[model samples]
Target: MLVFIDESGDPGFKVSKGSSPAFVLALVAFSDRAVSLEVQAAIDAVSKQLRVFPEFKFSKSRPEIRDAFFDAVLPFDFCIRAIAVQKERIQSGYLRSNKEAFYSFFVKSMLKFDNGLLKDARIVIDGSGERVFKQELSSYLRRHTEKGAIRSVRFSDSRNDRLVQLADMCTGAIARSYRDNRDDADRWRQMIKAKIEDVWDFR
Candidate 1:
C-alpha cells in the first residue's frame, strides 16, 4: 500500500492574529501500485491538456484548473482520510503553542483512526520541516502506530510526487469546507465525495 500525506492551513494557534482558522491534514491511500501509476498518468495528461506546470498545487492553481484536476482524478481507485481541526476549540496550551507536537498529534490521530487500513503501508509526507524533525516525526509515528502496520515513513517534495500533490488537493477541499468565505467549498468535494472514506472533525 502507498500513502501520501499533505496538509492545508497553518498549525499556529493565533487564528485571530493571522493564523488559519482551521488546520487540515489529509491522507490519500492507494491499495494497488498499478492504480497509483494510472492516477499519476492522468494528472500528467491533465496538466499537459491545461498547459500548466507539471505539479498541480491546490493553493496555487486557479479555481477552474483545480476543478479540472479533481475531475480528472476522481475516476481512479484511492481513498481519502482527513482530519479538520478547529484551532479555536483546542484549549491545550502545549498543543496550541508547539507546532511539531500539534502536527505529530494530528498525523498520528488520523492514522490511528484508520483502523488497520494503514497496516504495512509506506507513507510519504510532504517535506516541510528540517531533516531532524522529519526523522523525529517518522520515529514518533512508527512507535505509536499499530505494530508492524507501518512499513516505512519518508518525506518527499510535493513538486516531485504527484500523489502528494493529490493529497494537497484533497486537504484543500476539506479545509475549504470549514471556511466561511469559500461559497463553492462543496463543489469540488461533491465531485469526489465517494472516494473520501473518512473526514474527522476535531471539535
Candidate 2:
C-alpha cells in the first residue's frame, strides 16, 4: 500500500487569534501504485490547463480550478479517510500546548482506524519541520500504530510530490466543508464525495 498525507489547517488552539477552528488531516491511499500514476497525470494536466503556477493548493485555487481539479480526478481509484477536530472540543493541555504532539496524535489516529487498507504501507507526509522532528514523527507512528500498518514514513516536498499535492487538495476540500462561514463551503466535498471513504468528526 502507498499513502500520502497532508493537512489543511494548523494545529493551533487560538480560534480568536486567527487560528483555525478546525484542524484536518487527510490520508490518501492507493492500493495499486500504478493507478496513482494515472491520477498524477490528470493532476498535471489540470495544473497546466489552468496555468496553476508552482503547484495546486486548495486555499489558493480559484473556484473553477477547484471544480476542474475534482472533476479531473474523479474516475481514479483511491480511498480518502480523514479526521477533523474542532479546537474547543479538545480538552488535553498537552495536545493543545504542543503543536507537534497535536499533529502526531491525530496522524496516528487517522491511520489506526484504517479499514483493512493499511499494512506495511509506505506513508509519505507533506514535508514540514526540521530533520529531528521528522525522525521523531516516524518513530512515533511506528510505536503507536497497529503492527505492520506502517512500513515506513517519509516526508516529501509537496511541490515535487504530486500525490502529496492531491492530499492537499482533498484536505482543503474537507476543511472547507467544515467552515460554515463560506457560502460555497459544501461545494468541493460534493464534487469528490464518491472517493471519500469517511470524514470523521473527531470530538
Candidate 3:
C-alpha cells in the first residue's frame, strides 16, 4: 500500500496578486483493490452527485467527466483531508517564508496517519522538481524514523505523474471546498485532526 499526499496553492507569505485562496493542505491514502472498494464506492457516489466526469482529470485531454458509477472511478478514492490557510494570516506574516518551514508544516499535517502506517509502506510524494530538496528530505526521514522501518519518500514531477494525479484530486477537493464555503474550513481542519486520531491506533 502507498499513501499519496499533496497541497495546492502556496502557503507562502507572498500570495500571487490575484489569488483569492492562499493555500490548501491535502492528504490521500491509497491501497490495492481488495481494500479500496468501499472507499472507491463512496467516492464514486460523490463524484456522481457533483457530476464530475472523466474530463475532470488533467492527464487526459478532452476527457469526459462521467460519474464514477456512470463509467468507473479511479481505482483509488481518498479519505481526502485538507486545510486552507487564511489570507489574513499570510499577510500578517504568521506563517514562515522559508521553504523548509512550509514543508515541515506539511509533514506535521500528514503525520496524522498512524505513526507506523508508513513503517514498511512506501510513501510516494509529488516531486517539487528540486533534486537537492528531495534528497535532503529523504535523508532526513531515514535519520528520524524507526530503526529499519523508515517509509520511503519520493517526488514526481508533472511529467511522470500517477500518484501525483491522485494527490491532485485530493487537493482539488479541498480547494473547491474552501472556495465554496469559508465557514466549513474549520470543520475541515478538525476532520483532519480526527482522522489522524482514527488511524493512530490502526496498527
Candidate 4:
C-alpha cells in the first residue's frame, strides 16, 4: 500500500530549552482507491466529535479533539500509524533528530508487509525541510522495495491531489495527541512506538 508520512510539532529541536514538547510524526498509509474515502471519513468523525470544523486555520485558536479520532482512524482497510516523539526523548538521546528518527521508524514499519501495493507503490509524503523529507523517503523505498523503484510521488500544497490535505489532517492528529497529553510523555511515546512497531517485519 502507498503510505504518506508527515510530522507535526517542532520535533523538539525548534527550541533548544523551553518546554520542548513539540516533536511529533504521524505515518498514514493508503491503498490507491482507499485514500480519499478513509481519510475523509476519519476526519469528519473527528470534526463531529469535537464540534469544531477540521479545517480550523493554523492561525485560529486550537480546538480540543477527542482521542477517539486516533482510535477510530486505525481500523480502516488501509493502515494508519503515528509516531509522537517528545523533546525530552530527543534531548536525552532516546531518539535521533526528528527527520532521521521518522525515516528509520517509517521504512522499517512499512517495509514489513509485502502487499501488491508495496511492489509497485506510489508513496506520497508531505513536503518538509527543503523537500529533503520526500527525497530521503523515496530513496529508502527504492533501497527496500523489491524492484528498488518507487513510483512518481510529489510533495506540495497543491490541492489538485487530495492526499496532501489528508496527510495534513493526520499531521494535525499527531500534534493534538502530543499537545493533549503533555504530562504523560512516556505513555504517549509508548503508544506511538507500539503502533509503529505493530506492523514491523525485519525481513
Candidate 5:
C-alpha cells in the first residue's frame, strides 16, 4: 500500500493570537499501485491546465482551480482518513506548549488506531517545513506506531511530490469543515466526500 500524508494548520495553541483553532492531519492511501499512477497522471494534467507553477495547493488556488482539481482527481480510487483536533479541547500542558509533540502524537494516533487497516505501507510526508521536524517525525512514526505497520517513511518536497500535494489538498478540505467563520466551509470536502473513509474529531 502507498500512503501520502500531509497536514493543514499549525500545531499551535495560540488560537487567540491568530493561530488556527483546529488542526488536521490527513492521509490518502492507495491500495493499488496502478491506481496511484493514474491519480498522479490526473494531478499532472490538472497542473498543466491550471499552470500551477510550483504545485497545486488548496489554500493557494482560487475557487475555480480547486473546482478543477477536485473535478480532475475525484474519479480515482483512494481512501481518505483524517483527524481534526480542536486545540481548545486539549488540556495537557505539554501538548499545548509543544507543537512537535502535539503533531507527532496525533499522527501516531491516526495510524495506530486503525483497526487492522494499515499494514507494511510506505508513507510519504510533506517536507517543505523544517528538515529536522521531518526527520524527527520519520523516526517518531517508526518507533511509536505498531510494529511492522509501516514499512517505510520518507520526506518529499511538496513542489516535486504531487501525491503529497494531493494529501495537502485533501487535508485542506477537511480543515475547512472545522472553521466556524467560513460560510462555504463544507463545500470543498463535500465535493470528494465519497472518497472519505473517515474524518475523526479527536477529543
Candidate 6:
C-alpha cells in the first residue's frame, strides 16, 4: 500500500488575528501501486484536456480545475481519511502555542483511525518544512502508527509527486467545507464523498 499525506491550513491558533479557524490534515491511501499510477495518469490527462499545466496544486488551482481534477480521479481506487481541528475549541494552551506539537498531535490522531488498512504501507508527506522538522515528523509518525504497519516514512516535494498533490486536493476539499467565508465550500467535497473513508472533527 502507498499513502500520501498533506495538510490544508496553518497550524497557528491565532483565530482572532485572521488565522484560519480550522486546520485539516488528510491521508490518501492506495491499496495497489498500479492504482496510484492510474490516478496520476488520469490527472495528467485531465490537465491536458483543460490545456493547463500537468502539475496541479490544490491551493493554486482554480475552482473549475479543482472540480475537474477531483471528478477525474474519484473513479479510481483509493481511500481518504482526514482530521479537522477547530482552533477555537481547543482548550490546551500548550497545543495552541506550540505549532510543531499541535501538528504532530493532529497527524497522529488522523493516522490512528486507519484501522488495519495502512499495514505495511509506505507513507510520503509534503516536504515543504525544514529538513529537521520533516525528519522529526517522520519519526513521530513511525513511532505512533500500528507496530510494523508502516513500512517506511519519507518526504517528497508535492510539485514532484502526484500522490502528494492528490492528498493536498483532498485536504483542501475537507478544509473548504469548514470555511464559512466561501460560497462554494462544499462543491468540490461533494464530488468525492464516497471515497472519503472518514473525517474526524476535533472540537
Residue by residue across 32-61, what tens digits does model 2's lDDT show? 989999989999998888888788889998
| Better-scoring candidate (lDDT), 1 or 4 | 1
* Residues 1-203 of candidate 4: C-alpha lDDT, one tens digit per residue: 56665555543354656535554445555555655576666656665676655352222324233244445555555545554455444443534455465444545445434444354556666655556755766666666666743565556542333455444554554465445556643332343333343322121
Per-residue lDDT of candidate 3, residues 81-199 (tens digit): 44556655543233454656556545554553344544464666766747887787777666655655545777766334444555565465445455545554433233233333222
Model 5 vs truth, CA RMSD: 1.3
Counting clashing residue pairs in each candidate, in order, gives: 1, 0, 10, 1, 0, 1
Compared with the true structure, the alpha-carbon lDDT of candidate 5 equals 0.89
For residue 41, give model 6's deviation from the true position in Å. 1.0
Candidate 4 residue pairs in backbone clash? 11-23
Worst 10 residues of 5 by lDDT: 125-134
The Cα RMSD of model 6 versus the native structure comes to 1.4
Query: lDDT of all predictions, in order shown?
Result: 0.90, 0.92, 0.50, 0.50, 0.89, 0.86
- Model 5 TM-score, all chains together: 0.95
Quote model 3's TM-score.
0.59
The total of clashing pairs for model 2 equals 0
Off by over 4 Å in 1: none
Say which prediction, candidate 3 or candidate 5, comes out ahead on TM-score. 5
Backbone clash total for model 1 is 1
* Superior by TM-score: candidate 4 or candidate 5: 5
Residue-level lDDT tens digits of model 1 in 1-203: 99999999989977778998889999999999999999999999998999977688887889999889998999889999999999889999999889999999999999988967887899999999999999999999988888877999999998888899999998888888876777787777777799999899987
Number of the predicted model whose lDDT against the real structure is largest: 2
Q: Is candidate 3 or candidate 6 better by TM-score?
A: 6
lDDT of 6 by residue, 1-203 (tens): 99999998898877778778789999999989999999988977897899876577777889888988888998999999888988888999999899999998998878876766788889898887788988898888888888877888898887788888899989998888987778988877888799998888886
